[model samples]
Target: MKKYYLRAAFIIAVGLFISGCAGKSDLSLNIINGEKLEENQLLTTKNSIYLVNGGDGMKTTYLSVVYGEEIAEGSGLAAVNIANEQLCAYTAPVVLEKLVITEKEALENAKLNQSDYVIYSRVEKWTDPLGINCTVGYYTDEASVVLSLYSTKDEKLLNTTRLSKSSCPFKINNIPVSTGSAEILYEELFANWKNNMFAKVSK
Candidate 1:
């Protein structure tokens, strides 16, 4: 009965685009679409999962609801250090959470469905829509992640994959990406990023 990881930290990094631009998508949607990719792999007993550098979404999936949404891009690591104090109680099979964390923690925890897993996400890109003119800048970012699940019982691989994405949306008609209103757009991109990754896994 030692400390467990129930909390997470979020980091959103932003920097100017050098000059190499890439094509972006135009469609916008809510609840970003996700399609489970073909994972055909099973589980093994020699490995353990680690959710590193990415946001808190992964932690929310397996940890308690109290720590739900506790970590994400730019989250404080100190908060995780503190929450670990109560983490031991959650390590039991009866306390294992869900495949993915929602807004609420299930009143009665259940045994682990799978073996141990790891989630790692990193935001490598952020920028304004407009340039130096102040009328055409926008905020955009790229996130990359890897999820690993090791089975102490199986000694194989289960539900594992490596995912990486650099998401950004520029004004098609020169409308200029707005930083003040970027939250909505940023959320949209993040949602898409998350959905796509999950889609690949679910399949």
Candidate 2:
């Protein structure tokens, strides 16, 4: 009877832990930084048939979040927004997308197959995940994520920043925090990439 009671209690505790980690994390977005902007911009597309091509007369560059299989939820677009809003402001309301991969991969590959950019930056870290528990009393290890920009143009890498390891037990805190941190890192990384190698090949 005592053993059974202990097992049941442990199971309940585990259940609660799991719920705390993922139950509240409904969406991975809300981190893409372009929410507050003053001047919109023109569409950056070189050749296009889409009517949303230019001059919305707003400051918010309408950027769509890129959902990817290997995506870190809201990480990619969030970062991109941060960069867009800060770098060289425009009045044309540019359209941006968070991309795990762009559709113009073939063109990129053909042009910048030898680009030398490989900038990496760590945005956040947490570990032991929340799935495992031990006698160590909520002991979690250090896990980290890095934001990288591969310049498909000049092959130049920049701003390999590593953020501090976020002390989180699970997704409850880590997901949001990591998502925000990663965005900031990517924004910085891409901004520099623009100055160095971006938009050189695929424009």
Candidate 3:
């Protein structure tokens, strides 16, 4: 549950760009915490799924504070897109397009969809080094999110996992690159979370 505060003076213009042969990312994800039911929570092959927007659309604190709501919403939508793409492995999840601020509403939507389970996510921390010196750009971005799984059958919480990524490094020709937003780090976080959730549910 770490909070990232952006300095008002760090806000910079949007014209900065770096050019280079993009190298493999140096991003590594960490599991901040996770919880699960004592009973096995494995999923069957062809299960109905729903994803409730857990207020990530307008709740990105540092992004909104630094780059305005438009940038924040874009980053938040990137998160949703990641979830949608990755969840297609099982089935194209029924995703709630609008932000749902309350868990009750989220669960109700899942129930209405007749989903076997529902996934909910909240962005916890985000850091964008827009003004940080580009010379030292190895692992400058960071993002964190908490994902919870609920069984719509009984409307009971089944599992929760918090994943974080702060080690994403953009490089070209082996040179580090710094961007104005934390989108890269956020992608890494969501990708890792997807893998983790699949592992847990398949167990």
Q: TM-score of the candidate numbered 3?
A: 0.61
Q: Which of the predicted structures, 2 or 3, would earn the higher TM-score when compared with the native? A: 3
Candidate 1: where is the Cα deviation over 4 Å? 1-140, 155-160, 176-203
Which of 1 and 3 is the better model by TM-score?
Answer: 3
TM-score, per-candidate, Cα-based: 0.29, 0.27, 0.61
Candidate number of the best lDDT: 3
lDDT per model, in order? 0.30, 0.33, 0.57
TM-score of 2: 0.27
On the 0 to 100 scale, the lDDT of residue 86 in model 2 is: 48
Q: Lowest-lDDT window of 10 residues in candidate 2? A: 49-58
Q: Estimate the overall C-alpha local distance difference test score of candidate 2.
A: 0.33
List the candidate numbers ranked by lDDT, top first. Answer: 3, 2, 1
In model 2, which regions exceed 4 Å deviation? 1-72, 90-95, 102-145, 149-152, 156-159, 163-203
lDDT of 2 by residue, 35-139 (tens): 211123212323221011011011111121243112234443344455456443621222343334432442244243332222222224222233222112223
lDDT of 3 by residue, 1-203 (tens): 12322333233221232323332234444444446433345554466777766654333333455665432344444565667666776554555545655667877877778888887777655555543322234323556666777888888887677666554345644454545345666666666656555534444
Superposed Cα deviation of residue 60, candidate 2 (Å): 30
Best by TM-score: 3
